[model samples]
Target chain A: MREIAAVFLSTVRMNFRDRRSLIFMILFPIVLTLILGTALSSVSGSSDTAEKLDSRAALINQDHGAMAGRMEKFFRSPEIRKIVHTKTYRSLSTAKADLKKQKLDAIIVINKGFTQAVENGSSKKLDFITSGDMESSLIKNITQSYLQRINAYRAAAAFAPQPAAPLLADHALSINGKIPRSSDYYAVTMLIMIILYASAYGLNVVREMNLSPIGYRIRSLPVRQINYLIGKTLGQLATVFLQIIVLVTFFKFIYHANFGSNLPFIFLVCFLLGFIIILLSIALALLFSYKMADTILDLAIPVATFLAGGYVKLSILDTNPIAVALNSWLPNAVAQNLVFQNIYGGTGQTAAGGVLKLTLIALAILLLTIAALRRNNHADLSK
Target chain B: MIIEVNDLIKRYKDFLAIDHLNLTIGDGELFGLLGPNGAGKTTLVNAILGLTAVDHGTINVFGEALSTSERAIKKQIGLVPQDIAVYPELTAQENVTLFGKLFGLRGEALRKGVADALEFTGLTDIRNKKPSQFSGGMKRRLNIACAIVHKPRLIIMDEPTVGIDPQSRNYILESVKKLNDMHCTVIYISHYMEEVASICTRIAIVDKGRIIAKGTQEELGRLIEDDQVVSVGVTAPDYSIIEKLKRLPAVKDATVDGHTIRIVLSERKLNAVLDTFLEEDLTITKIETNTPTLEDVFLTLTGRALREGAQ
Candidate 1:
C-alpha cells in the first residue's frame, strides 16, 4: 500500500507541475463558457421558461438544374419559414459574408450541378455554414431534412408523375424540453468537453511508468506491475479531480452559470466522464504507441462532442429510434442531458438511468484497460 | 554465481536477438559488457530482469528460477538506464525518497537510504533543487542516486556516463567501484573503452547475440596472440650484436628498423632481451613494447570500433 501511495503521489505531482497543459485545460473552458454563455443566453434557457429564439438562415442556389429549383422553392416554402426565417441570396459569397458577420445564423449552399448529380447519384454535399451552433442548429437541421425529403420525392417522381411541389417530412427533430439557462447550460457542457479531454491524461502518466526511458528504470525496481497501475490510475484521477473542481467553481461563481442545487450529482456525472477518459487513454496506450494513442483521442474527442450535441442543438434524425438512442447514449450527451434534466423540473428516473449507463460504460472501459495491460505485461515497453 | 543463464534464445520473428547465449556472473564481480549496436545487450539485460521471455533456456537470479512473480527478485535489482530518467519535476531528495519507498524502504529506513544516496552521489547540498535546474552532470549523479537508494544486491548500469562532463564521469565510475567494494555485484555496460578498461574486473565482449570473448583484461588481450614482440632502440645497430641476439635461444628473430632492434619471443623474457643489449656495451636510448588495450581487443574481435555504437 505504501508503494502504491508513492507511485500515486509521483503521478499527481508530475501532473500538477505541468502548469502549461493544466492551465490551458482549466482556463480555455472558462473562456469558452464566457463567450458561449453570453451568445446563447436567450436560446438555451431553463427547461420550463426556456423559449426558442427566432432563427435566421440564408440559401444560395447556383444550380441551373430542375432539382436545384425545387431546393430553392423548399427554402422559400411557407412551412420552413414558420420555424426558420429563410432568405434567398443570388451570390454564394454574399451569403457566406452575412453568416460570418452574424447577420444570419446559417447559410445552406447548393452547388451548380444539383439536378444532374441527383439524377446520376454520384455525390452530393450540402454545405452548412453557421456562426454559432445554438441558433444555426435549427436551420441546419431543417435544410438537411428538406434534402432527405427531396431525394425521396425525386425518386418517386421518376416512377409515378408525383405532385407539383415538395413537402416537409411528417417528423421534425426538436430540442425537447431540456434547454436550461444558456450560461449555466454552456457551463456544464464546456466543462464536460474539457473533462473528456482527460482522455490524454493516461497517455502522459502511463508513459512515465512505462514506454519512456523512466519506465525502464522504474520497472526494474522492486515494485509490482499492479502497484504501478493502481497508483498511476489513482493519481491521474486525483489530478483530473482538481481540474474539474477549479473549472466548476469558476463556472458557478465567476461566470454565474447555473448548477441548480445538484452540485454533488453534477460533479458525480463529470467525474465518471473523467474516469472514462483516463481508462480509454490507458487502453489506447497499451494497444498503440504514445503518438498514435494521443492522436486517436485528440481526433475522437471533438467528434464525440459534436455527436453529443455539445457544439449545437443536435436534431439530426432525432425522430428515428436509432438516432435518439445514439444521441442520448453518448457519454458526453448523457452527462449533459442529466444535468439539464436535474436542474429543470424532471423526475429522477432519467437521471438515475443515465447514471447507471455511464457507470456501466466506465466499468467496461476499466476492464478493457486492465486486460490490455495484462496482455502486454510480458512485452517490453522501452524504446 | 549470483546470476546464471544457460542457452537462452530469444527471437523476434526471423531476427534472433539472443541466439542460444550462455553466461554466468559471480558475486561481487564488476562485470563489463561491451558490444556494438544491435548486439543483443538490451535483450540480455531484459532477460535477466525477467522482462523478456526466452524461447529455450533458463535464467536464475539469486539462485532462483526467473518467473513472473519477479516482485521478490526485482526488489534485489537496481537499474541505471542510459538516459537521465529522473523526474525533472521532482526535487533531488523527493526523487530519491520516492524511489526508495517504491523499493519498500519504511519511514526511518527510507529516510536514511535517501540521505545515504544523496550524500554518496554528492547531491546532499542541493537535495532541494529540482533536476530541471541541474546541469547535465548533476542530473547524471541524480540518476545514480535514484538507483542506489534501495541498495539492491545487483545493479545494472547501462552507459551511465554517456554524455556527462569528466568530473561526473569519474564520480560515477567511483560510485560503481564503491558499490562493488560493498560486495554488491554490478553489470556495467559502456561504449567507452577506457571506462570499461579502468574498472571492470572481468569483461565480456558480445557480438551478434553471443559472447565472443569473456575474461580478465589480460586474458582478452592474449586471445589474439600467442607471442609478443620486444622493440629495443639503440644508438647503433651493429651487425655482430644483431646476429648474436638472433642466435639466442627462444628469440624468433631480431630485425633492425632505423636505430631500433625488434626482437620476437615466444614468451615474455624481458630480462634476457635487456641482458643481451646491456652486454653489447651499446647505448640504449629508447625501449618500447606494444600491449593490446581493450579498444584493440574489441576492434580485433568485432572488427568495429566500440564507439561506433555510440555514434
Candidate 2:
C-alpha cells in the first residue's frame, strides 16, 4: 500500500511538472469552450432587422383585390414583417439572379392568380427560391402560420360566425415548470469533453513504462505489477477529478451555465465517464505499446469526442450510423446524455440504462488493460 | 550464498543463450562476470534478476527460490544497467527517491537514502537537476545512484562504464570498490578485460554461452605461456626482414606491418631474440618487452582479438 501510494504521488507530480500536458489537458478545453460558446450565444441572441431580411429574401406581390389587400396587410403584420423584409420585384428572373449571387436567403413569389385561386377554392403555388440552406425551417414555420390565419379568416366570413384571431401560446416542454436554456446543453457537452481530454492526458502516465531506466528499476524492485498499475490509474483519476471540478466551478460562476437539481449527480456522472475514458486510454496505450501511446491518445481523443456528439448535436447521431453505434457504447455519450436528460427532467429509459452500461464498459476496459499488462510482463520476462 | 544458479539453460528458438551454467556467488563477494560481447553475461544477469526466465534451472537468492515469491530477494538487490537508465525528466534526487520507495524506503529514510546514494556517486550537488541538464558522466552516476539508494545487499552492475569520460569511468570504478568494501556483494559485468582484471576478485570468462575460464587474475594468467610481447618501431623494411625474423627459434611468431615489427617470445628467450636481431643488423629503432595482460590471455585462448566473439 505504501509503495502504491508512492507511485501514485510520483505520477501526479510528474504530470503537474509537464507544462505542455497541463495546457493540452486542462487549459485547452476551457479556452475552446469559451471561444465557441461566446460566438454561438452572440449569433443566437442578435435580432433580425429589415436590412438583414432584405439581404436574406426577395418578395413579389400580385394581389390586387380587397381580399388581396387584407392578405398583404396580414403578411405585413409585425410578427411576420419582423422576420422578413419584403422587396417588390418587377420579374422573377431578377429575384433569381440575386438569389444566385447568394445575396438572398430565398425569393418569395405571389402569382397574380393567387387571390382568384383562394376564392374559387383552388390551390396556388407560392414559389420560394434560395441558394442557401440557412433559415429554411424558420421560413417554413412562418409561412404555415400565415396560411392558417388566412384560412381561419375565410371560414369566419363564409359561416357568418364571429371568430377570434388565432393565439400563439408558449407550449414548449418544461422540466419542473422551468424550460432548459442553451447554456445547460453547452455546460453538459463542455464538461464531458473537458473530462475526457483531461483523462486522456492523465492516462499517458503509462508511457513512462517505455523508459528503460524506469522499466529496469521496476523490474528490479519488489513492487507488484498490479499495484503499480492501480497506482497509475488512481493518479490519473485524481487529475481528471481536479480538472472537472475547476471546469464545473468556472461554468457556474464565470459562464453562468444552468445546473439543474442534480448538480452533484452531474459531477458524479462526469467522474464515472472520466474513469471510463482513462481506462480506455490505458488499454489503448498498452495495446499499441507505450512508445506510441501519446500518438494514439492524440488521434483517439478527438475521434472519441466526435463520436460522442461533441461538435454537433446529439440528435444528429440518428442519421450517422457510426456515431449511432459508438454512442450506444461510448461512455462519454452515455454520461452526457444522462446529464442532459437530468437537466431537462427528461425521463428517457435509455438515459436510465446508460449508468449501468457505462460502468460495465469501464470495467471491461480495465480488465483488458490488466490483460495487456500481463502479456507485456510475459514478453519482457521472455526477453 | 547470496545467489546460486544450477544447470541454467536459456534457449531462444534453437540457440542456447545460457547452457548448463552452474555458479554460486557468496554474500559480500565482489564477483565479476567477464566476457566479450554475446558471451551470455547479460543473459545470466537477467536470469538472476528474474528479468528473464531460464529454460531449465534453479536459482536461489537469499535462500529463496527464484519464483513469484522471489520478489523478496529483489529487495536485497540493486541493478545498474549497462544502459543509462535514469529518467530524463526527473531530477537525480527524485529518481533516487522513487526507486528507493520501490524498495520500501520512505519519508526521512527515503530522503537520507537518496542523499547518501547521490553523495556516494559524487552527484549530491546536482541532485535537484534533471538528467537532461546533466553531462553524460553525471547521468551515468545518477543511474547508479538510483539503483543503490536502498543499499541492497547485492548490487549488479552491467557494463556501467561503457561510454563516458575517463574521469567518470574512474569515479564509477572507485564507487564500485567502495560499495564492495562496504560489504555489498557486487557482480560487475563488463567486456573490458582490464576493468575486470583491476576490480574483480573472482572472475568468470564466458565464451559462447559457456564459462571458458573462471579463477583469480593470476590463476587465469597462468593458463597461457608467460610470453613477453616485444615491439620494435623501425623505418619501412623489406619483406625478407619479416621472413628472416620468423626463422629465429626464440621468436614464437613475428609480424611486420607498416614501419613496425611485433614479436612474441617466451620470457626466458627474450634476451636471445634481442641479441639475434642486433647481430642480424635489423634496424632496431625501439624495442620494449612487457608482461602478459588479460588481453594476451584472451587472445591466447580465442586465437583472435579480445573484442572479437568466439565462434
Candidate 3:
C-alpha cells in the first residue's frame, strides 16, 4: 500500500511539473466550454428570426373564375399568414431565378381550364415548380393538405352545403405552433461534445503510464504490479473528479446551465460518467501501444459522440433498427437524453430507467477495464 | 553467500542471452563480472535481481530462490543501473528519501540514510538540487545514492562508470571500494579490464553468453606461458635482428617493425635475452619490459583486445 501511494505521489508530481499537460488538462476544457457556451447563448436569443418560414411563390392562374379567386383567398388565409411570409412572382423564369437565389422555396401554377374542368366533373392538373434539391418536402406536404381541404369544400357544396363559412375560416388561419429552437438543440449538442472532450482528458492518465519517468521507476521497484496499477487508477480518478467539479461549477454559475431539478442526481450521473471514461482511458493506455493511442482516441471519440446523438435527434431512430438498438445500449446517448429530459421537465419511470441503464453500462465498462489491467499485469510479470 | 546462481539460462526468442551460467558471491565480496559488451553480463545481473525471468535454472540470493521469492530478495538488493533513473523534478535528497521510504525507512533514519548516501557519493553540497541541474557525474552519484539509501545487503552495479568524465569515474570507483570495505557484497559489471583488475578479488570474463574464463588476477594471467612482453627501440635494427631473436632459445616470438623490435618471452628467459642483446652490441636507444597483464591474457586466449567497445 505504501509503495502504491509513493508511486501515485510520484506520478502526480511529474504530471504537475509538465507545463503543457498541466495547461491542457486543467485549463483547456474551461476555455472551450466558455467559448461554446457564449456562442450558443447568443444563438438562443436569435430564435425568433430563425422560426419565420419563407413562402415566396409564382402564381400562374389559368382558371379565370370563382375557383381561382377562392384559391387566392385560401393562400391569404390567417392560418397560412402565421406559418409563412409569402411573396408573388408573375413568370416561371423570374420565379426560377428567385428560387435559385434562395429568395423563394417553390412556384405554383394553376393550369388552363382548371375551374371549367372542375365544374364539368373533370380532374384538373396543377403544376408545382421548385429549384433542384430545395427543402420542398414541407411545402409539398402543406400544399397537398390545402388541396385536400379545397376538394372537401367542393364535395360539401355538391352534397348540400349548409354554412361552409366556418370551414373556410378554419382553413384561412394557419396553425402557428412553435417548433423547438435550434439553439436549444445546439446547446445540448455542444454540452455532449464538451463532456466527451472532458472524458478524453482522462486519457492523459493512460498517456502518463507510458511517458512518465516515475512509472518507469516504479516498474523497477519491489512493489506488486496490481498495487502500482491501483495507485495510478486512483490518482487518475482524483484528477477527473477535480476536472468534473470545475466544469460543473463553471457551467452552473458562470453560464447558468439548466441541468434541472435533480441537481444532486445530475452530479452523481456526471461523476459516474466521468469515472467510466477515466477507466476506459486507462484501459486504452494499457491495451494499445503508446504511439497509437492518440490516433485511436481521435477516431473513436468523435464517432462515439456522433452515434450518441451529438447532432441528430434520438427520435429520428424510432424507425431505424440499428439506432434504436444502439440507443438502448450506448451510455453517452442515454445520458444525453436523460439530462435533456430532466432539464425539459420530463419526469417519469422511463427517464429514470434510462439513467439506471446508463449507470449499469458504465459499471460494466469499468469492470472490463479492470479485467484488462489484470491481464496486462500478468503479461508484464512474464516478460 | 549473498548470491548464488546455478545453471541459469535466459533465452530471448531463439537466441540464448544467458546460457547455463553458474556463479556465487560470498558476503562482502566485491565480485566483478568482467566481459566485453554483449557478453550477457547485464542479463545475468538482471536475472539475479528478478528484473527478467530465467528460462531453465535457479538464482538464489541470501539462500532463497530469487525468481519465485522476488520481494524478499529484492528488499535486500540495491541496483544502480547504467542509465539515469532518478526523477528529474525532485531534488537528490527527496529522491533518496522516497526510495528509502519504499524500503520501510523513514523519519530520522531516512534522513540519515539520505545524508550518508549523498556524502558517500560526494554530493552532500548538492542534495537540494534537482537531478536536471546536476552534471552527468552528480546524476550518476544520485542514482547510486537512491539505490543504496536503504542499505541493502547486496548492491549490483552494471557499467555504472559508462560515459562519464574521468573524475566522476574515479569518484564512483572509489565509492564502490568504500562500500565493499563497509561489508556490502558488490557485483560490479564492466568491460574495462583495468577496472576489474584494480578492485576485483575474483573476476569472471564472459564472452558470447558464457563464462570463458574466471580466476584471481594472477591465476588468469598464468593462462598464457609467455609472461614477458619486451619492446626495444634499436636505432633502426636490421631485418636480421628479428631472425636472430627468433632463433634464440629464450625468445618465443620476435618482430621487427621500422626501428623497433618487439618480443614476447618466457619470464625465466627474459634476463638471458637482454644479456644476449647487450653482447650483440645492438644500439638499443630504449628498452621496456612488462609482465603479461590481463589484456595480454585476453588477447592470447581470444585473439582480441579486452576493451572491445572502449573508445
Best candidate, DockQ: 2
Report the C-alpha lDDT of model 3 over A1-383, residue by residue, as the tens digit: 88778767765665556667556654665565455444533533443322444445556566668776676677677876554445555666777788788876666777777676556545565776654221242343345456555655666767834312211111111212222233444444555555555545556555544465444445556777677677766665655556556656666676565555576666566666666666766666677755575667677777766666564433233224676566556666666666665665322225568667867877887887778777665552222
Q: What is the alpha-carbon interface RMSD for each candidate?
A: 1.8, 1.7, 3.2
If scored against the real structure, what TM-score would every candidate get? 0.74, 0.74, 0.68
In candidate 2, stretches whose alpha carbon ends up further than 4 angstroms from where it belongs are A34-191, A194-206, A255-263, A291-298, A314-316, A342-352, B88-90, B106-112, B231-287, B303-311
Q: What is the interface RMSD of candidate 2, in Å?
A: 1.7
For candidate 1, lDDT tens digit of each residue in B1-311? 88999999988778788888989999999999988767888889988987776788999998998684588888888888888888888899999998898888987999999999999999999999999999899998999899889888999998899878998889889989999999999999876778988999999898788998999999998885655667788888776887887677866666676898876665677777788778988899887776756766776566566667733
C-alpha DockQ of every model: 0.42, 0.51, 0.23
Chain A TM-score for predicted structure 2:
0.64
Model 2: per-residue Cα lDDT over A104-194, one tens digit each: 6666666677777666544465665545342432343344455545556655666736322222110111132233334545566777887
lDDT per residue (tens digit) for residues B1-311 in model 3: 88888998888888777888888889988988987777788888767767676788887889998656778777788888777888786788878888887766767988898888888888889888899899988888998998899888899888888889999999999999999989998989988889889988888888777887788888898776556778898875767667777778766667665787777775556666666677777888988887877766665565456666422
The Cα local distance difference test for each model comes to: 0.77, 0.71, 0.67
Candidate 1 — which residues are off by over 4 angstroms?
A38-179, A317-323, A347-349, A380-383, B225-289
Q: Following a full C-alpha superposition, what root-mean-square deviation does model 2 have from the true structure?
A: 8.9
The predicted structure with the larger DockQ, 2 or 3, is 2
- Superior candidate under TM-score, 1 versus 3: 1
